[model samples]
Target: MNWIILILAGLFEVAFAFCLGKAKETTGNEMYFWYAGFLAALSISMGLLIKATQTLPIGTAYAVWTGIGAVGTVLVGIWVFKEPAGFLRLLFLTTLIGSIIGLKAVSSH
Candidate 1:
């Protein structure tokens, strides 16, 4: 389904963000490797997004895509990169998730 594709695309978006974060923390060959991973993930994410947009409304798809990426990246930051997970941060994340779900529920497709 297109929704599944969209979700995978969003996941890849998070993967690319993770690669960028890792690249930022490394050097030389390792850094280049991470950058390569970023490029690959970016390509795949974009491709899936384009595919999903064929059936899903562009606005809804894009918002959901970015929402998933934002939520996922933030969680990745907390778990992998040891970023802050304060109360306000989590509260906003929960809201973002709700918004994404609401968009999906309301979508005509």
Candidate 2:
């Protein structure tokens, strides 16, 4: 259950990250909406992270949460934002993913 919540938090973190850029891209009313969404997502993500830390090791939980968010945000950047996806970037991303998996495997819960 905690893991599920943490994953949702990570997804929201990714959403907020994208919303940050979208907010910057727009003007006036549109920017306000995006900013509001970013704040909401950020709040939810932080709350879930705090909850997950109650059971999971803080270091492992934080690493996995940020790992998910980082990987997700990177994918969004490459696909939706039209950012460059060079070989080195993908390689490091895969490495980070491997580390996340390793952390999960070693975690007792």
Candidate 3:
């Protein structure tokens, strides 16, 4: 389904962000490799987003896509990059997840 595609696209967006983070922490060939991964993930994410938009409303799809990317990137930052996971941050993340669900539920498609 397009929703599944959209979700996958969002995941790729997170992957691209992860790649960028990793690239930032590395050097030389390793940095270049991470940048390559970023490019690949970015390409796939955009492609799937374009596909999903064929069936889903553009506004809803974009919001959900970015929401998923934001949530996933934050979690990745906490788990992988050892970033802060304070109370307020988690609270906002929960709300964002709820909003994404609400958007899906209210979508005409």
**In model 2, which runs have C-alpha deviations exceeding 4 angstroms?**
none
- In candidate 2, which residue pairs clash? none
Cα lDDT, all candidates: 0.99, 0.95, 1.00
- TM accuracy, model 2: 0.97
What does the lDDT read for residue 95 in candidate 2? Answer: 99
TM-score of each: 0.99, 0.97, 0.99
Residues 44-96 of candidate 3 have per-residue lDDT tens digits of 99999999999999999999999999999999999999999999999999999
List candidate 1 stretches off by more than 4 Å. Answer: none
Ranking by lDDT: 3, 1, 2
Among all windows of ten consecutive residues in candidate 1, which has the lowest summed lDDT?
Answer: 90-99
Candidate 3, which segments miss by more than 4 Å at Cα?
none
lDDT of 1 by residue, 8-79 (tens): 999999999999999999999999999999999999999999999999999999999999999999999999
What RMSD value applies to candidate 1?
A: 0.3
